[model samples]
Target: MDATKRPLRIPPQFATYAQKHELFELYRRLIARLLMEKPEDPLTFMLEELKREDDDVPAIVIQGPPASGKTTIGKMVSAKLRTAHITPQILLEDDVSPLAAKGRAIIDKNQSIPMELWVQLIQARLKLFDCIKKGWVMEGFPENREQGLALQQVGISPKHFVILDAPDTVLIERQMGKRVDPQTGDVYHTTFDYPSNSEVEKRLVEPPEGCTEAEMTQRLVLYHRHIDGLRRCYHKFTKVINADQPKADVFSQVITALSSKHRSLAPHIPRIVLLGPTGCGKSVQAALLANKYDVISVSSGQLVKEAIANESKTGEAIKPYVNRDMPVPDNLVLKLIEDRLSQIDCVTRGWVLRGFPRTREQAENLDTAGYEPNRVFYLDVPNDSVYERLTLRMTDPVTGIIYHTLYNPPHSNQIKERCQRHPEDSDDAVQKRLAAYNAYVEELSDYYQTGLHINADQDPHTVFEFVESMLVSQLPTNLDRD
Candidate 1:
């Protein structure tokens, strides 16, 4: 048996104790590192990894337009993580460095600091002893792609990057009611986060006249223009926080992102299984994960179709049942799945399996065949959502792409005209499938109780983010490795 698939033999209480202290998680991290490093001295390597885990520091970057709460959330996260909180002002005030002195000179002349000088100033601050040893959280820097890349070129990179976002209307309203304490530089909002202390309230003052509504609006316009490039640059490590929520919720998300350990990329052979009802986007999410992680995507239905097209022996055996719209025998289907997953590519690079093991028997058969999934996700979409998705979505014959009528219309008329609905997508057929799924889903759920259930009714991108976060969190962060 593959060591990963070996069954654990332990008492229930011992398992509970390990879970409480996250010992299983630590073991997963160590195994991932062992696979990637493949050192001869495995024990010493593991000990070094443990030591580095404790000593590793966090470098975080928080960015947003004015009044988007970057400063407040950045400070809160820094304090919680026990890292230094840094800002552009803090870096500029450190006139000991030549870059800071030059930046201050430009600021003193009432001119905008160029991207080159801004990058130098921030990079210098990040290279300081305290920032290197304890890590630092920086706010309101790298406003454009050029600056972000320049910092990267100079070997300055953040372990975690956050973009706090809100609607323009909400941001404008927040700025309108914004207040600051001149002595403490603490920001407050008149409507949202007013100062509770009477002394602080008495000392609150509005921002300068230059921080006007029109100016803030212009800044927002510029932010939207430059945001796409910045997002692309930091896409892998980035987390977007909805700043329109309450302050505590936003801070909670920030802290979670900062404190959570996530692999920069998968170094293990990921055996992922995505389970959901018909039209719950199991295939879609599986394809996305495959493409993102360079894993093979395996769909049982697609595999059967391809086999039939190729006229293989297994295809010939199963064609009759498929042609007559009959369910293939479980033994034959499991045989086909076992054969496919035993291929060299699936064994080496990894694979994302979709629309398989629909029953408890099939799940058991897979384990017996020595093809166990390391990660299983059950997309929890409602019946109504599945009905809407199937009934209203169209499939492109030429491209084999599926698009929803309301949520994902075709980009051009040419593609839209050729799109067709599957015959089996009728309401009656959907009801029957849903009923069948409901019958066996409980058994499958009971069998794979460790599987993560994802709420799939949200936007597809949001669902993907939630799933990806879980996947990345399995391995240790790559900060120390780098």
Candidate 2:
């Protein structure tokens, strides 16, 4: 049977779009008539067309943050086009034992295939030229500039690059909520929007020991490199979909882009998440992380505030506790966290978790509930320093900006009236608060032994340097000393 000249089978659902264009309308009517009167003949004609040389199956590339539904979308798109879904990860995994036997260090301790493994996998996949003649949807390959170039060297160029853009806040929240099956590596997230079978909970896997901030950053850097390559080479053939929007809306935009005949450019979308503590300059640090990472910050406190304003059940439960300087119930806090994480934009990128897990019990709840941190940073400010800093705290009534009267006073002291008034009995209250804070720190120090501690009394830039140093030290290297 001929492969290239096969008769087209336009689904009934797409009949409307086909009717809107003259060329498509004629083709659609002809196909519909043939299907009704001469089904055998139409199949035979399509087989002939399949054999013809002019028809080429379209190629679509889907890219997005981890757990952003890229794989699911890839599968759906491939099914719609009646093409093979080729994921490089699958290819590499199939060949891992053989590749490793040949001295190819293909697998990391995380059991993920390395870059070289991808190169080998791509080379092997490309050998199936005849099989891919009908085209295939390639997912999870060309992870960086080098890999992309490698694919180009092997004469494989995708027709379109579909970039799924989502906010990092969404990504982080999603990631924190994500659970993978240890046995089969199936990924699942807890959400009403993406419901999973109750049995899926049994498959949750624990992350490997020593999964540190440095390790997470290394993976991110690799992702960045690959994304950069996609932007550089396929910039013209790119279609960016904001995955932060409603799933249906995002899918519609994707379908529209894929059905279009010509390639079009899409805007670059950034995802960011901010993480820090209360009154330890987490907000300021979040801004720094946002600027450095080129993504937006998702503030947990802000989310809680919004929830409280909306009088969400969980928020309402937390309101009295927070107002009375008491910790909310673990289940209530978890509900709040879960709700915030389910938002489309929160789990897409790096994010900060501010004003969360203030107590050891809360932190333990986070771990038990499966919200692990790639890194935990402690701002090690002395009690005296914190006292001095809080003593001068002031708020701008108009802009809601926080200022320090000692170091960052308002212009000409015009807003001095807005300075936070210390309690007449503040001396005792401050001492009590300091004692509680110290106790919390002592427990935190014990809990996260590997946590990076930055001196908060220093200049902000200097503290950032310490952060960068910690990150650099965490990179994958054979050096014994960290």
- The model with the greatest lDDT is 1
What tens digits encode model 1's per-residue C-alpha lDDT throughout 388-442?
9889988999999989899899999999999999988989999999998888999
- Window of ten residues with lowest summed lDDT in model 1: 7-16
Highest TM-score: which candidate? 1
RMSD in Å for candidate 1, one decimal?
A: 13.3
User: How many residue pairs clash in each candidate at the backbone level?
Assistant: 0, 37
Q: Alpha carbon lDDT of residue 251, candidate 2?
A: 71
Candidate RMSDs in Å, in order, are 13.3, 24.7
Model 1: how far is 134 from its true place, Å? 2.1
Q: Assess each prediction's global lDDT (C-alpha) against the native.
A: 0.82, 0.60
TM-score, every prediction: 0.50, 0.41
Report the poorest 10 consecutive residues by lDDT, candidate 2: 263-272
lDDT of 2: 0.60
Off by over 4 Å in 1: 1-56, 259-264, 270-482
Cα error of candidate 2 at position 142, Å: 25
